[model samples]
Target: MAKWGEGDPRWIVEERADATNVNNWHWTERDATNWSSEKLKELLMGLWVEGEEGKCEITEVSKVE
Candidate 1:
């Protein structure tokens, strides 16, 4: 192991006044609920499937949760 003050720089955590994540290395939280719901609805709606004498279509996506 390297000595206390001679360790690799990448392993060191820099001091910050706000104590935020350094270099965005940590996991950050984001709210995507509305965006994901809309995206799912857009992708699911208007889909159609046909096989032999059967056919089905997704005309509307009411909820995605």
Candidate 2:
């Protein structure tokens, strides 16, 4: 696996007052879903489980539909 922070700079989201929400977030590419599987996994490295009781890392992800 590749190291973290070793991808395109355009994917990086720097802090900005106006870009606080998802709607105003800046991006170099328009298609946000064009990321690779590895990139997607890396982006979601550490995450708490939703609709659960305790805190935990998200080991897997699946589509509901």
The numbered model that scores best in TM-score is 1
Which candidate should be chosen as best, given lDDT against the real structure?
Answer: 1
Worst 10 residues of 2 by lDDT: 25-34
Each candidate structure's TM-score, on Cα atoms with residue i matched to residue i, is 0.61, 0.26
Stretches off by above 4 angstroms in model 1 are: 1-10, 13-24
Error of 2 at 29 (Å): 14
The lDDT values for all models are: 0.83, 0.59
Let me know the TM-score candidate 1 reaches against the reference structure: 0.61
lDDT of 2 by residue, 1-65 (tens): 33576766766555578656566444454554535655777767676675557677876755321
Q: What would the per-residue lDDT of candidate 1 be over residues 4-58, giving only the tens digit for each residue?
A: 6887888776557997986667867689999999988888888899999999999
